[model samples]
Target: MNSAKKFFQNLAKYLAVALLVFIIVSPIYWILVCSFKPTRELIRVTPTFVPHTVTLFHYVGLLKETGFMTYFLNSIYVATGSAVLVVILTSLAGYSVYRCRYLGRRFFFNILLAIYIFPRVLLLLFLYPMFARLNLVDNLLSLVITYVGITAPLNVWLMRAFFTSVPLELEDAALVDGANRLQILFKIFLPLVAPGIAAVAINSFLMSYGEYLFASILIVSDRFKTLPVGMAQFLQQYEISWGWLASGSVLIILPPVIAFAFVGRYFVKGLTAGAIK
Candidate 1:
């Protein structure tokens, strides 16, 4: 009787969770279906769950007619660049903090954490004006630098936590065998902690990709605009093309989805590595 009762309880919990998942995913599934339909079918009084006849016209127009391709490429560049830079710099910073015995290390880490706790939006007011003074606005390089700085702190903190779980005796053994700090890091430590690095990369990529406020404020020219900003302009007050808008939205979400799907295991491993230990 007890086993039978437990079985039904577990079944009830699974059904509830499944329903919640369906609710969350339903809107995105609808958007994908609408992207294939035309403008008229998108807003018909009768809503259709699945489109009858699919049209590639909206996708084609966004690709060829509008500057969507340029924006898409820019987003790829910025996100990729920022993710790589953050992974490299933050790994080194984290290793130094976790593995080294430098003076005032705790103090430096405390200050760094405090900065991260402070909202980035607050920093934007000061940074935008300073960049304007230096004529750094509207430059891809400046945007890249800004992204790196913003993504670095949290990555460093997370990685530092992960690295704390690594055995220091391994480094000591390598050092006794005449290996230098850089050699030990490149050869022994990095390979073992690769999961954490991958997680940091994914986090940085998402942050850079979804960054709308900074991209909107910093970029002026249509050519240098990222996907987020382009999407904003795609939606306007008077006329919102549901089909075309949905198409653009689908296109915007594709890269991140593909990226996460590919690196998913690595991301999970990295984020949850030392978290369990």
Candidate 2:
């Protein structure tokens, strides 16, 4: 009876997880279907789960007719730049907080945590005026700086956790071998925390890539607009092109999905370990 009960509980858990997965993935599946379906099929009263006729018209239109490629490239530039900056600054900051003894270290960490929790909307009010004063408004560099500021604190905490888990004896041995602080950081410490770095990179990349609010507010010119902002232009005052919108959505997700597929295991491991530690 106990064995049977255990089996039933396991089955129940599996069913619940399957249901949750279906709920989350359903929208993605629908968007993919809509992307391939022609305009006639998309606006039907009843939606079809599977497309009878798959067409690449929307994809072709997005690439050939619109400024999608420009937006895509812009997103790539900003996301990559922001992620690199976050990783570099966070790694150093994390190591310093973890290893170096300093006055107000705890206070500094508390401030970071507080910033991490603070609503981003609140920061925008302050950030905009400062950027405007500096003539940084509507600039890609401004976007990169904002993204780094938003993502770095959390990433710093993640790296700090990973750094704390590194064995101090290893650093001591490296020190004994005449390795300097930078050498120890680059050669010895970095390898051990590679998973954490990957996690931070993925997080930073995704955050900047998909961020709409700041991008929309900061970028005005069509030349500098990111994917999310560019795609939103489809929903104009008069009409919405569902097909092109779906195609853009599909395209936007592809890079992140491919990235996560490669580093997913490490990302999960790093985050879980950091949280536990």
Candidate 3:
């Protein structure tokens, strides 16, 4: 009787998990199906769950007819630049805060947390005028800088937590062996906190990649617009290009999905390590 009860319990858990997975993946599946369906099928009174006729016309149109490739390249440039800057700056700042004894260290740490907690809209409101004054508006560099500033605080905090987990004894031993601060930092400390760096890089990249408000507001030139802003073009005053929108949506989500698949283990480890410390 106990064995039977255990088996039933396990079956119930599996069923619940399967249901959750279906709910989460249903929208993605719908989008994929719609992307392949023709416009007539898409706008039909009765919607089809599965496409009878698969078409690559929408994807081809998006690439050739639209500025999709330009938008894609712009997004890649900004996101990659912002991620690298954030990781480099945050790693060094986090190490200093964690390892060094300095004036107002606690105060600086508190400020970082406060900035992270604050609403981003407030910052954007203040930053827009400054960017305009500096002629940074409608530029890719502007997006890169804004994204780095927005993502850096949380990443710095995360890196600090990771640094705290590294053994001080190891650093002391390195120092006694005549290794300087930079050598110890680059060689010993960095490798141990690599997972944290990966987590920061992933977070920064995704945030910049998907960010809509800043991208839309700051970038007025079509040539400088990122993928998120470009995708909005499909929804015009008269008609919405559902096929193109769906296809673009698929492309937008693919990069992050691929990135997570590659470094997902390190990302999870870094986040968990920060939480525990």
Candidate 4:
């Protein structure tokens, strides 16, 4: 009786998990399928679960006609640049908060956290005037700077948490062996918290890549527009280009998905480590 009950319980647990996975993945699968379906098939009265006629027309049109490649490259540049800056800056800040015995360190950390209290639109309103004065309003650099600013606070907090999780004994031992501050930081602390850095990098990249609000407002030039803003061209005043939109969505989401796939383990470990600490 006990064995039977345990088996039944396990079966129920697996069933529930399968259901949740299906719910989460079904939309993504549907979108991928739809992107390949021909326009006529797409608008059929009876929706096809799978495309009967798969074609690359949407993808080809998206690439050739709509300046998709330009937007994609621009997005890659901004996202990669912001991610690198965020990781470097946040790692330094996190280390400072962890190691330095300074007055009001706690207050400083709190101030960083306080940045999130204000809405992004409100921040952008203030930031736009400053950028305009500096002649950075329509530049890709403006997007990079804005993304870094928005993403840094949380990353700094996460890095600090990761730093705290490292034992002080390691630093002390390195110091005893005549390792200088930079050496100790590079050789000891960094490797230990690598997962945290991976997590931070992924977060920053995704945030900057998909950010439409700031990108649209800051970038006026069609050539400088990122993927999100460029994709919005499909939405005309009258008719929506559902095919282009669906194909664009698939492409837009691919990078982040691929990124997470590679570093997802580290990302999970980093978050759990920070949470525990």
| Predicted structure with the largest TM-score when compared to the true one | 3
lDDT of 2 by residue, 148-231 (tens): 999888887766556788889999999999999999999999899898888889989989999998998888899999999988
Q: Please report, in order, the local distance difference test score of every candidate based on alpha carbons.
A: 0.83, 0.88, 0.88, 0.88
TM-score of each: 0.91, 0.93, 0.93, 0.93
Better of 3 and 4 by TM-score: 3
TM-score of 1: 0.91
Better of 1 and 3 by lDDT: 3
Once fitted onto the true fold, the runs of candidate 1 whose alpha carbons sit more than 4 angstroms away are 1-7, 273-277
Q: What does the lDDT read for residue 239 in candidate 3?
A: 74
Model 1 sits at a Cα RMSD from the real structure of: 2.2
Cα lDDT tens digits, model 1, 55-81, are 998898778767789999999999999
Candidate 4 residue lDDT tens string, 2-91: 999999999999999999999999999999999999999989999999899999999998788788899999999999999999999988
Q: Is candidate 1 or candidate 4 better by lDDT?
A: 4
Q: List model 3 lDDT by residue over 59-141, tens digit each.
A: 99888878889999999999999999999988888897888899999998788778757787887897889999999998899
Worst 10-residue lDDT window for candidate 4 reads 233-242
